[model samples]
Target: MVNPLDHPLFARVSHYINLINFLVLVPTGFLIHFPYTGAPINLVRNLHFIFMYSFLINGFVRFYWSLFSKHKDLVSGFLWNKHDLKTFWPQIKYYLFIGKQPNNPNKYNPLQKTAYLSFPVLALLQAATGFILYKPEKFGGVVSALGGMSAVRGMHYLIMIIFLAIISVHVYLVFTEATEMFWLMFFGKTEHKKGI
Candidate 1:
């Protein structure tokens, strides 16, 4: 029997585009937040906005693809449910190296589902705060609603930290639990065991 495709080419391409855009966005954003030494703040700010748009557009593409693609079941599985509750602990233990990998029919385990679903929300927050910071005059209402510019800046920085943490764990799990999946995601094909 043939194994099903874990990630379609469109999904794979979108994944890399988001990854690349994120990789650029973080450093540029950081520089914008904390500048030093003839940093050419204008140039960095422009780069950050450019990559931010790219990331958002890629995210939109992935969302659209997930809704209408043959693998739409993945979106349905994105939510938490009683079944996910039951499997959550086992999945955690598997990650902690204290238990076997839980048998999950879906491509993602409970933890993965939760983390993956959160990206869009976090991305939107990051973008909102970013825009507010970028144009305080125009977004004065938003800035005030979010408790002033300081709060908006703090939120944008905090969201960046959260993204860093999530990406770190994601990369760790990919290398530790299912190395081949990373290759499959990147190259769109790889020989691997059925479950992984």
Candidate 2:
């Protein structure tokens, strides 16, 4: 049987890469933010840039896959409709332990789609801010538009905190509410209930 939760190999691989990139970027980014006297600051910055590029590339691949792959319908969850708006409250209540889960048979519910869709925008903001910090001369116009270096730095740090919060909630839900999803993301397929 064709498992609805089964991801294509390319999708799974991109996800893995993105996960690893996130795992590396967060710590290295922190280290860069709060540098110590003995810390290898250059190394941390290098790793941060490397993984940041990997994350961006992986995001582009996922975007391309969404556009060209056979699973366009599945990837198009980022585009929502009136039904999604109607179900949003129910989904929120379910996550908050106040109501039953929404009975959607697709891979991602409206809430999940909403959360997943925000990542790319967050990533782009992170990338732009990072590049501005990395090469202030190159992004002088952007920095000025964003209210100078200090403001850009603040925005970048704030965005990172947002990423942390979202990732924490996502991980919690995956482990507690959808353990199979964790496996499915890594292995590309999962044995789960009909709705997944």
Say which candidate scores most in lDDT: 1
Clash-forming residue pairs, model 2: none
| Runs with alpha carbons beyond 4 Å of true place in candidate 2 | 1-5, 73-76, 189-196
Residue lDDT tens for model 1, 143-181: 888899899989998999999999999999888877777
Report the error of model 2 at residue 172, Å. Answer: 0.9
lDDT of 2 by residue, 1-196 (tens): 3364457677778878987998999899889989989999999999999999999988888887788778754445567766787788999999888999877765677877877889889999999999999999998888999999999999999999998888899899888988777767765556454544
Q: Among all windows of ten consecutive residues in candidate 1, which has the lowest summed lDDT?
A: 1-10
TM-score, cand. 1: 0.88
C-alpha root-mean-square deviation, each candidate: 3.6, 3.7
